[model samples]
Target: MQQQTLVNFQNFIIATRDSGYKSTASALAELVDNSIEAGATKVEILINKVQEQGVEQYEVLIIDNGKAMSEDELNLALQFGGSSRFNSRNQLGRYGMGLPNSSLSQCRRVEVVTWKKKGEFLSNYLDVDEVIDKSLTRLPKPKKSTNCVFSIQSKSGTIVLWKKCDRLSFKYLKSLIKHVQFELGRVFRYSIWRGVEIRICGETIRPFDPLFIGEGVNLKGGLPYGEELHYQVKIPNNEKKTSVVKVRFVELPVQEWAKLPNEEKRKSQITKCAGATILRANREIDYGWFFMGDKRKENYDDWWRCEVSFEPELDEVFGVTHTKQEIKETEFMSSILVPDIEQTARALNNRVRLKFIDLKRIQPQVFSKQQLERNDMYLPPVKKNDGLVKKNNGSLKIKGLEYEIVTKELKRDVFFDVEEVDNCIVLTVNTAHIFYEKIFKALHSRRINNIAD
Candidate 1:
């Protein structure tokens, strides 16, 4: 039998390009993963807007100060599923498909240049146009190339250039930069926290801890709810071997953050974000309702968070994909981890609900605060102040609606007075009235005593 080609090079390359990389950020992440595995401390992603045939297009250049590759290593890195660190359980890379696969998914041509010794740069590339035309049967031999990445280098570095781009997201420039930075920050929060610096278009990417329990964040949440869950999950590749999986839960400050502006809540990714962040080897892969069987999500659930982290050895258990954007369903994962997680999730939801209930109980006037917005935010502001001197009025706004409840000595015979101040409505009960000395004071005392019951 005459041995024929295993795959149609033209069609395969095109199909591979289309098959991989669901998002521009995911593809870029693969390249950065390689850089991190190479021990890169500093990485930069530069976005360039170029005009091609009267149309505006974008090109990306990824530069890293990692250990550069030699000619032989560079050749292998350019090939599909080729890596010296294949199946590496400790490092970020595993299948070795990241470099070329990630690059071609965004652009038609990708050139990689690397150097360890000064003035001895090695370069290689894979061009979609060449493969389709059959002019370039294989990767052109890596040769000495000009140091296009940097003019000066200490010892080693690598540069990846993407050209003829087509598969980028619809957003560009500011939008694209913002999206990438947000995603990279969340996905690589651990790496960033570990002193890895990632800059996009000269702007430094900050770590965005989903749980909101870390420092340097504008928002904060309560401490971890319970003890960390540890599981020695079996590694799919080696049935006899197993790895560690850590699970933790956190409760966001519902009473503290529930009154923030809608935009701030949305920007902080707290509203409607009731899910766990699945981390593999300290890198976030999937973030959703994982390992929580039959648990329906609710508004109160948003007040809590979960994080499940595992070693690279248990990738199959987590159903991690090559894209690493999301996880697929795994029977082993569900059967092993779901019960405990689901139970804890329910407890957390109940805790949040009860906390809100307690808040309402402590502040019986909370309903007034709620109504200030539901029934009256559309009303015009009051320019006419209350006919009294304002000192320590203790007036405040909640969700942009001003409200106050205080006791004051009213010269009138009324039990209470309702006055609209500049920005709020003040409900002042007469302190000298019999309603305060008898009904109001006694009622509050009984309610306070009921707390012990």
Candidate 2:
């Protein structure tokens, strides 16, 4: 007879927790995925901070008004890879590892309480400490619990509680709450627009449309760059079924926004929107330089944007991971979409460059008006002033023609003012521009660093 061995549950749980989740926002997204897959319309996330051993810690609770699970299903749901709907492609969750893997990755203990009708509730929990000490070998059996965080107002609902959150990314409650709201707003914008209600700490979260398609949040003065493009992609391992991937392009009002302050530009995410935003099953998975072939990204590319969205059946083609945070950019993704995306990106880049040049031409005319408003008098250069002129030396040569260089200090409101007169080029800098106010003033105002202290 051959001897058989079993895997150690405690060691496995610890190793599984380190499965490369980038942030707490991603791990929480996994829980929200389960709720959406269960046909939940309303989901609420709550965070509580308390002091333990003189140190502050946080606990997270997620309540969903979805179809609740039975006692047998709840027991199986607590186990890794135990979902009855494993490998089902009709919903968001395909791999059964999302629930436990995501919960345990951020917390030391996870408890689930569910109910089917009023006055009847069941609960199950898993604690890492108990597992490591060998006091608990498996998930606790579902039993009656009156301490459930969610009230049984609906016919069916589930509540997931995470205690001892030691691996959360944010240490403060306010930062964590803000991060969650922003991330979820983008990740589930499509679903939220379609009537899903998501709330955090009693406040509703509004959808943030990355495409700027005018739902509630959109790019200022944004317009469609081109018509929507559609591509038929064959699902991997299933040739009979084809998935339609939609590609759309949007261009921001660069002419109107290029002059914005650095802080305002950063807040608008204008400079950061340089590449394509990839959406899997209507949720944004990743955003980067994708399927652009060999074309390199340029600074001017930030004025325009692209979006690639596909169904969940093409997950393998896009190389979507179980974490749902990133994509692998496999060869299949490149072969089907690279050619068109690269061509479109180049065309958009040229258009933006021309717009910027056109805008530059108008700036000189606008600045001329500001120049006329200054009433301060300025002294003209004296005629035949030898001190202001310097003879051309052998070291000075321009296009094989040597010329004398003249420099003069002009008291104007501009940064640079240049002119050519009497076979000599004059270079003058104004002292009234912001370049002088912020930079020149700061540098010259110091009195030799207080005479070296």
Candidate lDDT scores, in order, read 0.80, 0.77
- Looking at candidate 2, the ten consecutive residues that score lowest on lDDT are 367-376
lDDT of 1: 0.80
Q: Give candidate 1's root-mean-square deviation (CA, Å).
A: 4.7
* Residue-wise C-alpha lDDT for candidate 1, range 1-453, written one tens digit per residue: 989989888998888887557688888899889889889999899999999899888889998999999787898898887888876777778887888888898999999889886778888888999999999888798878655555544478899999889888755578888888888888888899899999999889988899898743437665689999998877776879878889999989877776664556777888878989988888888788778889999988888999998887777766777666667758878887889999999999899998877666566565455555555657565545665635344444555546677777999999987667654677778999986776666655554444234
Name model 2 segments beyond 4 Å from true: 1-6, 145-153, 364-453
The per-residue C-alpha lDDT of model 2 at residue 314 equals 87
lDDT of 1 at 118: 71
Give the least accurate 10-residue stretch of model 1, judged by summed lDDT: 444-453
Candidate 2 residue-pair clash tally: 0
What's the distance in Å from true for residue 91, model 2? 1.2
